[model samples]
Target chain A: MKSLEQYTRFIEEKIAGINLEEEPRKLYDPLRYFLSLGGKRMRPILTLISGELFQISNEESLSAALTIELFHNFSLIHDDIMDEAPVRRGKPTVHIKWNSSVAILSGDVLFVEGYQQLAKYTDKRLPILLKRFNETAIEVCQGQQLDMDFESRDDVTEEAYIEMIRLKTSVLLGCALEFGAILGNQSEETRNHLYHFGVSLGIAFQIQDDILDLYGDPELFGKQVGGDILSNKKTLLFLKAKAISEASKDARFGDLLQMAPTDSKIASAKKLFEEIDAKNASLETMNGYYSEAINSLDQLESKGLELGSLRELANFLITRKL
Target chain B: MKSLEQYTRFIEEKIAGINLEEEPRKLYDPLRYFLSLGGKRMRPILTLISGELFQISNEESLSAALTIELFHNFSLIHDDIMDEAPVRRGKPTVHIKWNSSVAILSGDVLFVEGYQQLAKYTDKRLPILLKRFNETAIEVCQGQQLDMDFESRDDVTEEAYIEMIRLKTSVLLGCALEFGAILGNQSEETRNHLYHFGVSLGIAFQIQDDILDLYGDPELFGKQVGGDILSNKKTLLFLKAKAISEASKDARFGDLLQMAPTDSKIASAKKLFEEIDAKNASLETMNGYYSEAINSLDQLESKGLELGSLRELANFLITRKL
Candidate 1:
């Protein structure tokens, strides 16, 4: 019955204790630096919360929680390299601070270390856990592939963008919960309910992220406002905005989006998105997914599992999201 | 009871049956291309051979073999990007054919698929197999890191270079064999002996490679001879000559290796290595490891296992090395 802050502290201490600060400093130093630069640490906390929902103590789930956190950092380090990102969590990225070679090798080590953490669990469930992890890992790669592919093409639809987010980002959330449920000895069907709950919430959260990129509270947000617009990523809002522009024959909309990178471009793009109701449409879609997430949780409640803190966390993901 | 050629054919067919030729063509096409540009396929074949030494069928060991091959390709894809290598197996590398982003994502997929193949084995050995694979995977990264580190350091000793290659190139061979032995139900001690056998042979084979880069027949070699020289790699021959010139106080030898990249630079480097007896020194060192490899095989023989063709494979590794 620990508070969310307690779970966050446990995961952070576990991460800080991981001694990757060894020789071949070129290989491990960047990983140490990247892991030290923390974010919300939401995925590992999800693993802890999922375990608590199953009445498994967070102590029992620490190893798997570490697995999720390590894997998350692995994906981000490699993704930042592929995305050519300069900053992460208000700091230089692994590739930016060291080099891509260091980033690739360190990411590879982090990935292997993730499995090492999982292998620390000697249960018969180990093979099944590894299988699920392998599947989710491949899907994440495929999602990144599709995201890069979308960069050059303009015909990306809203459905495609949602699917991309599910693969790229959401499924890992699903898998993170699923790992805890699996470790907790929940049956496949019951564990899958927890998984779907994560998936729906993950999708909604991503949409909220797209909206926040334009209209979020700057003081609360870690990254630059309107950063996604600057990157030209085909997020859900961008897809919706493109459809609305086409419907209205707004000739100047395309020109506004393609303007030279500047403060004015972001302001103009945000103005057009609000005017065309793309922002509202994205929010509505986000709510729909959020509702679906709650429905999956209700399925769990029907089976007589208490989900008090878990539901609050989901609410916090949407209602009080920074 | 199959011949080495049949083992070779079995591995080729197993690799060919892998269908990564599906969607996200940009992500998969480069993988398909890199795999299709075949090398000696030596590591996977060793898995089959090791399995046979323990009277285990190749079919039982095929999954582990593919794991090794897929992982090998994964390392190469990422390493080639780090090395900025344009060519692989006489074809354009994945990073060259595609871009670094595609290369990074696709390599990540290949790494995960390696675990997928390993997971196909549903036995108690699965966890132990995964544990070994993860350890070997991390060491490979560390090895690559050390190799890159050596590129910048001028005072790298021979022992450090040997340890670096052992980590970078040799341990995977040892791991490939150990995986087969594990699947074959060999005792941990016996499997470890087999692992050492592969380790020694791998080290010797690498030193042989350094020698062949300067002295081997051109038609027999797949890569350009003296390619390492042109790249200014600090190979064993270079280290030996550096030591020799320091002892003899030959001032001209330092300038010979430092000359600009040209055909004649490679020729001068080769001639200087010969003059200093560095090539012979490397071969003697190669023989010591070759002997160490044979002694390990003899240890297996003392346990009453037949060592007929396996011994031949070891001898072939030394006698007929390209």
Candidate 2:
């Protein structure tokens, strides 16, 4: 099996080969620019890794990986516009660099381009793959809608939040892995196992992200620490703190949240989080998901497949600072 | 072959059967609302008519027609947002009624729904249909980009304008017809002929729309009669007027265009259009495309197919004031 580094390298090379310099320069330039401003490339890498684990040919799986990456970028471009975001991955967003209209149209073309890549697959599994992709794509949009709806409401439940993150974020990871497994001709059971594994890991990864947003080293996180707190974002930590504070009849947490996002206010919010043991609770939830992910992987191990690389990758993902 | 009214009724029935009331009401409601606000339903009707002309099964062609119509509405929702359009078909646009974010995400879902509808086609023609759809979808975006780009520039050539409109407006009509033709198992030659026929008809239809934007009755048009003129949109008429005035070395047309778009200024622009013979030039060009469209139909007729309904539809399209 290829190492994770080999899969990452393969994805990078494939992305580099994608030419986005077509006509209507305005439409494609933003696409090229957004793709150039790279992310972790984690989703595509997951696809390649799953393909390798399933003994798929590299050429057979490359297009699926490319499709996953392109879809990810397309979602980001549109999401950035909706979020009114100015920067992404330490660079200006497409909507900021160009304009919203350009971003909207370019993002749309990117979506079609992703499907165009997917249309290259002509296997018997194509229908299932396309169906899963469409369902996942729609769920992602629903998740975003739910996320926006949550922003305006103060009573977002933890269950609802987890479901939202699963739909918004985790399902894509699951879909990517399942896509690779399908291409590799894996059995339905193995595909389902990998999908569950990816979803559990994705949920854990996002919770870890929330924890890192407030507690990780500033330089390592590569973003403004406490950004969620500043924006009054109802992240997992905030929800947990609210729940704990209400149970304990403590008003300090609520008071801290209501304050303007000054340094002192952020400091107070952090202190309140510590006082409420929100970090430990969050870690507990994260570890539960991590264990669930391993349990899914263990089901695959019972089928006699080596999972050493996947285990290491999962550890790396859960333990990463950024 | 079905008459135009029969085709229209079939399309309306198919649209009514489409279920858009699935979960996440915020996400899907706007889609339902947008689709409910009716337009000409011209593209999908063309799909059905093309299918009928080729003697394809109605069940086989209905999904493709629904996909075309859904895709059209999807583009309109997003385009309305980009154009900052407040209304469409005499109703508030999705973005205006709800918000841009809702409109953007719903539009994204609508596009996915179109593909989901396409995924129902399990035939040898599936890949080709998907490929053509993707290519057409990308071109539509490029066309919209070019249109927006033209808005900020003064040097757009007539050739560039024609290409832009072809990308923006004509290709989808061609694609709708070609999609139906492919599903009908038509010969490649016949499919290409139908596609070009639709393209030529589409171009002439758009040119007629531009003409009506200025000269048609407001009640019949169901929109502000002088909207394009008021917005200083460089429609075919505006471009033709510029070309004609430059050829005659007349400055009145340029002067009129530069004036504020008051009622008197619109009157003066209309008079200038008459003086420069821009109306006659536009009509002549429209007739040329109408002829080209008929010629393509003639090629289809050579395949021993009757062309009465198509001829009637073409005449109705070019002759309609709105």
lDDT (Cα, 0-100) at A115 in candidate 2:
91
Pairs with backbone N, CA or C atoms under 3 Å apart (clashes), candidate 2: none
Q: So what's the TM-score on candidate 2?
A: 0.96
Q: Point out where model 1 deviates above 4 Å.
A: A230-232, A248-252, A258-271, B260-271
User: lDDT by residue for model 1 over A174-293, one digit each (tens)?
Assistant: 999998889878988888998998999999999999899888888776567988888777889888888998999987578977788788888988888888998999999999999999
DockQ of each: 0.82, 0.76
**Local error of candidate 1 at residue B215 (angstroms):** 1.7
What residue runs in model 2 are displaced by over 4 Å at the alpha carbon? A1-3
Give the proportion of true interface contacts each model preserves, from 0 to 1.
0.85, 0.78
Residue-by-residue lDDT tens digits, candidate 1, B1-322: 5676777777888888896748889878877877877777789988888888777788888889999999999999999999999887777888888889989999999998899999998778888898999999998899999999999899999999999999999999999989878988889888988899999999998999888887787777556788788877898988888889999999867797668888898889878888889888998999999988889888989999887776888787777544
lDDT of 2 at A297: 93
